[model samples]
Every structure is written in structure tokens, then in C-alpha cells.
Target: MSALAPDPRFVSQAPGPGQRSPFLRRLAHASEPWLYSAPALILIVAVMLVPLVLGISYAFRDVRLLNPFSGGYVGLQHFHELARDKAFWGALKNTLWWTGASVFLQFFLGLFLALLLDKPFYGRGIAQALCFLPWAVPSFLSGLNWAWLFNPVVGPLPHWMVSLGLMSQPENILSDPTLAMWGPIIANVWWGIPFFAITLLAALQSIPRDLYEAAAIDGAGGVQRFFSITLPFLAPTIAITVLLRTVWISNFADLIVVMTSGGPANRTQIVASYIFTQAFKKLDFGYASAVALVLLVLLLAYSMLIVLLRQSLLKKG
Candidate 1:
């Protein structure tokens, strides 16, 4: 018998330049990012999303840790309780003050430091490192350190204030209900300023030098150049940084828990710490989850407002 002829249908054609096997290649290309990100996505779902959903469920049901049978559905009972919770209202007010003051101070101070660092000088790198050192310290340690520094018996700050006539005598400001919130606020600002500075400095460095040069050549002075060139360029960064820091600081409870534990008549009890207190100390997980849900809603609203405002401003400009 004659040798079987080569089967034309089974013959393969070599892929030319820019050619590829469509189906498999397209699938791999589409799935490549998901494959690389699956681990992180799974971790986030496990750690964050799952807890969030569970907490929302807990908000509507009794989930006290110490109770043997506390998972009964309660509908809007927890929310109704939250509405009348005087302590929760107080904590909400404190959260606003804490977040506003901390973000304002941190942003301005960071901007100042970033501007200073943006310009070359002696020991510039060292100065940047020193300024950023506080951020490197763990949050708990920073809180404790500041708590110590506010202690009248051990710290010199109160004594120095007395010497400068800023106080009647060496007194622990953290013990004063009126001034207690300032303790955590100051610590937060110090620790957070470096973050804003680093972010702003990076944004500042990315600005084209020629814009400043053009502004200067147009008879613009320092202030004019700043207003006309720098401020406009930095506006987006400032808005985003402020928004993020506001939300983060509003939710932060570590410094308050470490420094004062929301003491002094609960004057420093922001919503976050109050939630922690309800959950951990009182073991009222339902109430704590309710409070957290409220906070989450408020934060979502605030973020949306900021984003809309930014978009509007961008359009107007």
C-alpha cells in the first residue's frame, strides 16, 4: 500500500509576528491580574468584608459574647437604643472635634514641613528622616509616650507650661475634662503629620519646574507664585489627604484607649473608643455594632460629599 498522504487538516501553521492563539491567550491575559490578586482578595474578604457583614447582622441581633443565647433577632431595637444613648451622642461630638482638629493641624504642619523639605538645604535628608521618625514609631508606643509626657509628676511639659504661665501649676492636662481630648489629638497630629508631609512632598516633586519658572518670569513674586502655581497644583492632593485622614482619625481609638481610656467623665470618648468600650468592656456587641453601623453610614455620606464637592470644584475650575 502507498504511504498515507500528509493530512492537511492536522498540519499546523506557524504564528506570524503579532499573531497569537486567541482563546487561551486571551483567557490567560484576562485572568492574569485576578490570579495575582486572588490571595489579597481572599484575605480582604476574610478579614474585612466578612467581619463587616457579620457586624451588620450583629447590629440587628443580640450577639453578646458572654451570653449563651444572645443571637436572637431584635430588628431596630439597637438603633432605637442608640438614638437615646446620651453617651453615644457625646462620643459623636468628641469624634467631630478630634477628627477636625487633628486633620487641620496635621495637614498644615505637614504642608509646611513638605515645603521646607522640598527646598534643598544642609542635612536635608537627615531632617526628613527626623521628621518622619515619629511615624515610624508604633501607634501604641506613641500613645504611651505622649501619655507619659502629659503626666505632671514625670513629664516636664506641664511644669514648663506653668513656668511659661500657660497653666496655674503643673497639672496633668489629660485629667482635665475640658482639655483631656487635646492629649490624644496632639499625639495623633504628631504621629500623622509625617504621612501627609511624605505624600505632599511626593506630589510637590512631581510638579513641573517649568511652571514655576514661567510664573516667576511673569513678574510673579513668592506669594503670587505660590497662589497661582503651587496652591492650584496641590489642591487635589490636599483634598484627598484631608479626606483620608479625617476618616482615619475619626475611627482611630488606640491613642484614646491607651492614654485616657475615655476617662475624665468620658470627655475624650470618640465614637470609635465608645464602640470599643461597649463591645469589650460592657460585652454589648449588639450596641457596639449598631454604633459602628451608624458611623459607617456617616462616613460614607461624608466621603460622597467630599468627592462630589471635588468634582464640582474641578469642573468649575
Candidate 2:
């Protein structure tokens, strides 16, 4: 029996001394990057992902803040109520208007400013800084400032409108249901335009100077060169910025909350402000979460649609 000599294959398969097994070595190699990133990953999971999951779960549960025993599961009852909520429907419509008008004004005005800033001029640096001043201001402060401007008592905007025949007389537009949404919309546009201006200016500067020069030499007009070269060069940037800004503006409640508090009979209540009202004012955390989830889904669908359209346009180009 002489130690029925160990098979050479088995001997070769086993790790010797303190050496790691092949499986362990492979796992260590694979996990090295994750080990380095563990802190950030853990922080994100704790701060963002955990809350997100909890919020989604709350959407299906009766998690009213006023009630101690309100954590019971309610399934889709909140959503069912949302379906019949006229206020929710109205807010959704207002959300569409708010997002569309704000994004449209911001992008075009910002593009114009970007184009103007891209050109060389004396005191251009000062001009650029002044143009971007609005964005540097906090949203809350901007909202307050704009609110005051819309006030007829101390602010001059209403008086100016009166002088220009845009208004019948000095009055607080924020108190008017027919015009209250415009108050926040104007404030948002002013605050958000600088974001587009900065991003679009960077993209504009990256375009080849020789392309514009060549177009000019070929007797192309400013409009022709812009449409043919500038716009084409800016298409991708425009698409992405528009999509992101649309989503952002849709979720933005700061201006409305500060300026109008979604007031004038909730006429200016956007979905985002409505969510705030439900969550903090009414303490209906479950219903608020449901509305938030619906908003998330809607934004996600919109983003996907925009991405698909961009891809198709790129393919065609």
C-alpha cells in the first residue's frame, strides 16, 4: 500500500504553502476596483438609493405623517384616487405649460445670448459676467426678487407694464389666477437662461472657426451660415440640454412655492408644487409619494422618447 502515491494531476491542482487558490485570485482581481470605490458606492446607496426605495414603497403604503399607525399597505389606492383627482389633472396640465414655456424661452434666449457672447467685443468679459449673474443668484432669492418685481406697491414692473400698455393699471400679477402662473414662469426663465447660455457658449466655442469663415467667404448670409453650420453643430447639445432642462423645470417648485405658493385657487399649482402641498402641508406622505412616482415615470418616458428621437436624427444625418 506504500502511500498509494498521490496522483500528479491532483497534486498540481492544489495550492501550495500560503498561495491563494485560482478561484480566490480571480475574485480578488475582480473586486479590486470595487474595493477602491466602496466608500462612494456605500454612500450613494445609503443616501440616495435607500431613500428612493423607501419612497417608492411609501407610494404603495398609507404613510400619512399625522397618523402613528398609517404604514399599512394600501396597494394602488393612492394611484386610484390620483386618477380621479381633478386637482392632480389640473396640475399635470399646468406642469406641461410650465415646462414647455420655461424651456422654450430659456433655450432660445440663452442661445441668442450665447451667440452674442461668442463674438469679440470691448468689455465682453463684463458683459458675460452680467449675463450669467441671474444663474449665480440662488433660486429662492431670485423668486423673491421676481415676486417683488411683480408687486405693484414698491416694484416698478407693474408700473412699467402699465406705461407700455401691457397692463390696464398697476396690479399684482401673482394674485391673478389668469396670470399667476406667468409670474413663476418668468422668474424661472430668468434664473435658468444662464445655465443654457453657459453650456451653449462652451459648445459654440468648440465649433470650428474656419467653417464659419469659409461660409462667409462663399457669400453665405448670417442666417444661412447659422442655419447650415451653427445649428447643425449645435444639434446634439440642443437636444440634450433641452431634454435635461425640461425635466428639471418640470420638477422645479422653488419659484412657484416662493412666489405664488401655488395660490390663486391653486390655479398656478403645478404637479411639483402640488406634491409639496400634499407632502408637507397635508401630511399625506403616501399620496405625495404616489404623485412623485407618477411624475418620475412621466419624465422617464419623456427622456426615452427624446433619446430615441435624437438617435434617429443622428442616423439620418
- Per-candidate RMSD, Å: 5.5, 4.6
Name the regions of candidate 1 deviating beyond 4 angstroms: 1-29, 305-317
Give the least accurate 10-residue stretch of model 2, judged by summed lDDT: 1-10
Q: Candidate 2's residue-wise lDDT over 1-317, tens digit each?
A: 22435556535677677776555666799999999999999999999999999999999999989899899999999999999999999999999999999999999999999999999999999999999999999999999999999998889999999999999989999998999999999999999999999999999999999999999999999999999999999988898889878888999999999998899988899999999999989999999999999998988888888779878877986
Overlapping backbone residue pairs in candidate 2 total 0
Tens digit of lDDT per residue, candidate 1, span 1-317?
A: 11434345422553355655444455689999999999999999999999999999999999888998889999999999989988899999999999989999999999999999998898999999999999999999999999999998889899999999999989999999999999999999999999999999998998899998888888889998888888889988898778877888899999999999998999999999999999989999998999999999999988888888778877977
Alpha carbon lDDT at 150, candidate 1: 93
Q: After superposition, how far is residue 12 of candidate 2 from its true place, in Å?
A: 11
Q: What is the lDDT of candidate 1?
A: 0.90
TM-score of each: 0.88, 0.88
Clashing pairs in 2: none
Error of 2 at 38 (Å): 2.0
